[model samples]
Target: MAPLRLSLACWDYDRVKAIEDGRVRPEGIELTFLNLRVEETFFRQLRYKEFDISELSLSSYVLTLNDPEPPFIALPVFPSRMFRHQSIYVNLKAGIHSPSDLAGRRVGTPEFQMTAPVWQRGILEDEYGLNYDSPQYFTGNVEPSTTERTEKVPLQLAETVKIQPIPKGKCLAQMLADGEIDALESATAPSTFGTHPDVGRLFPNAKEVEQDYFKRTGIFPIMHVIAVKRSVLRENPWVARSLTKAFASSLEYAYEAIHARGALRYILPWMQFHVEETQAALCSEGNDKWWQDGLTPQNIRTLDKFLEYSFKQGLAKKKWEVKELFAPGSLDAFVL
Candidate 1:
């Protein structure tokens, strides 16, 4: 039997680099890897099913569950995860000194339904006492460029929460910098803040805040999940396990390379110390696993919380179960 050839689209992260460089390959499959920006990948994959397998936004993926026939079925492999406390950017002139000040203020975001903003909003509401429904929202591109980006899925916002796009020529960063919006939450750093001194992060000690949040919540928020097209899964069911095994191997390979004490592979001078610190913060006491994959207890707990947040924020019509999110075969490890 000939091996199946499939297209996979995702960012070129260190964990997936082995698979991209052909050091690791999915069993019985030939992958054509497309290293693309996540937004483009998500847009194409979600809108047109552009690739056989691709990185998907968890929030967007949850929204698809409400569809009668979702175009994609996910694996438990999470390719991207980030602490979103650092994602909040606020204008110094907005009088928003604390999270509580965000209540009744205008806020801007690239997209309300995007995973980072959803996580930030949920965190603000749960941890900091900001009312989720109080702020008026403006959604637009984060960059200063004139190009506009729309939400991939329809939102189900509360009647009291108003959201609109910025004007055709403007962007969220500019809106935030000019004090047109009090704050902005985005996955990508807004360009204006680098040039404009007035724009600053909401949490100055973001690392400490994020570490504290993780210690309290036990959730290092997941941003993206890998998904295979439903038609491909229906035809080649074994591909799910194959891809899972390949990605896990790739992640292990990345860990070994990162932990090698000889020299720094990354640009940062204290990279090893940072890596060790991260491990201490995120990993369980006995295990060396920092960036874990699959639907383990911790991962499932995080996913369930994210789903609840999505539902509460009106991104998902209903709270989805973890079992329904992944292909059945992927829920267990395969043996040779």
Candidate 2:
């Protein structure tokens, strides 16, 4: 029998590099990995369903669950995860010295439903007494020269939630630096953050803050998941498990490369110290540390918390259990 051919749209993440380089092919599948940025992959997949598989935003993907016929199913294959403390940028004029001061402020974001913002809002609300509904939001591009970017999936915000697009020719980064927007929450750092003196990170001590949060909660937020077209899953049930295994293998490959301390694989001067810090913080539950792939209780709880965040923020109509988000065949692959 001929192998099933599949195309996957996602960024060139180090964890997924083995798959991209043809060193980790899914069983019974011939894969074509599309090296796309998260924004491009998300826009194409959510707008046009352009790929057989895609790296989908957790918030956007969960919102699609509200559709009568959800278009995609996922495995426990998370391609991107990050601690979002560094994602929040603020204007020096905003008078937001601490998280509590962000209440009733003007905030700009590329999209209200982007995963990083979702995580940031959730974390702020959960840990710092910042209400999810407090901010007045403006959506636009981060770079001043580009046109505003709208949500990939339209949002039906709660009556109390206030949000709108930034004015024409205005972008989030520039608006933030100019103090047109008091703060910005996004996955990508603004070009103005370092160059423009007015714009600075909300949490300047981000590494310390994020490390403390992880130690307290053990919740490393997942940004993107590997999703397959639901129609394709209906035809080839085994694809889910095959792809999951492939992704798991790819992560292991990444771990091996990162652990070769004798000769550093990356260019960082403190790569060894960084790896040791990560292991100390995240390795207690599993050998994979921050990149664990299976649907362990920890992983499921992380997904559940994110879904709760999406629903509470009015991005999803209702919260969904983690099992409902992935393929039936893939569910069993999750280790206890």
lDDT of every model, 2 decimals: 0.89, 0.88
| Runs off by more than 4 Å, candidate 2 | 285-288, 334-336
- Once fitted onto the true fold, the runs of candidate 1 whose alpha carbons sit more than 4 angstroms away are 334-336
Model 1 quality (TM-score): 0.97
Candidate 2 per-residue lDDT over residues 1-336, each given as its tens digit? 999998999898889999999999999999988999988899899999999999999888888888999999888888888999998999987798999888899988888999999999999999999999898988888886555577889778898888888888878888888889899999999999999999899999998999899888878899889889999989999998888888888998888888887887888879878888888877775464677876877788899999999989988888888888888888775442
TM-score of each: 0.97, 0.96
lDDT of 1 by residue, 142-216 (tens): 876656789998777788778899889888888888888999989988887778988999999999999999988
Candidate 1, lDDT over the whole model: 0.89
State in Å the error of residue 125, model 2. 1.1
Highest lDDT, which number? 1
Show the lowest summed lDDT stretch of 10 residues, model 2: 285-294
User: Who wins the TM-score comparison?
Assistant: 1
